[model samples]
Target: MSLLNDPCATPAELADRCEEAGLDLAAAPTSSDLEAVGAFMAQWRRVVACSEHEPRAATLNALMLEYASAPWLTDHAGTGWHLHFREPDVDVPRQIAALISVGTALHLSGLGMDRLGICAAGECSKAYADISRNGRQRYCSTTCANREAVRRHRATRASATV
Candidate 1:
């Protein structure tokens, strides 16, 4: 849920996020690689910005068009066979893009287009892809939800005292 907003994101931070996503990391990402990913994530923000289904789909479709190839199968490095939407020989940034673009498409299609949303808590502005069963997520996490709740309760008490 971190935003690189800058193409000059530090190598370690980029590596950590990639690692958390299960990407194989024999070495740290280079400057250009970080820049490429930063740019891609910028595009990703556009998808998150769209609150409605169609606009989100259109933005994601544009990303898939740019980054993904026709579906293909792979079992590279002894992993179990799985489908991929990217050419086998693409560079790291392109590969990452393909993985994310297709993954996002499936998630939105299977879950709900309204699943991707920003935190409703004041000034938090964090993005979250809601995977909860109920799908009523409004805040990014319990902390934000609690914070907003406290604010509401205090406001109610203050009004009662007036």
Candidate 2:
């Protein structure tokens, strides 16, 4: 959400966010790297836009087919063995695309296809993953939810006064 929603985000910002998410960036990202990932993020948005499960699953499957490699286990850093769905020694953008594609697949399959969506807030098109206990999320954040709630309350009050 942070990366996709920030249209002005730079390569340095992408590097920072990737580190925060525990992604192993082999080197500092370049503008081209960020652009590549941004391109992939656009395709990922198609999955979020689907109102029905079937389309969502199909879009995600296509992304996985394009980005993800066959699953493998590696201890590249000697820390511990971990599963990777991308080719070994891939660059930042390719690595990110592969990870996000496979991760979204695992998430939706484990949860539900409706788990990803665009925020219901009228003014926001931010994408969100519904990982809540009940899987009924409608807004991207509490701020958006509260803003919509306040808008509704004010509209109701004005209509009642009229």
Query: How do the predictions measure up, each by TM-score?
Result: 0.89, 0.92
- Residue range 26-65, candidate 2, lDDT tens digits: 7789999988988988888888888898888888889888
Give the candidate number with the greatest TM-score: 2
- Best lDDT among the predictions, by candidate number: 2
Q: What lDDT would each prediction earn against the true structure?
A: 0.81, 0.88
Residue lDDT tens for model 1, 3-105: 4322335777777777776776545678888788878988888887689888899999999999999998878857688887987778768877888788888
Instruction: Give candidate 1 misplaced runs (Cα > 4 Å).
Output: 3-8, 25-28
Candidate 2 wrong stretches, greater than 4 Å: none
RMSD of 2: 1.5
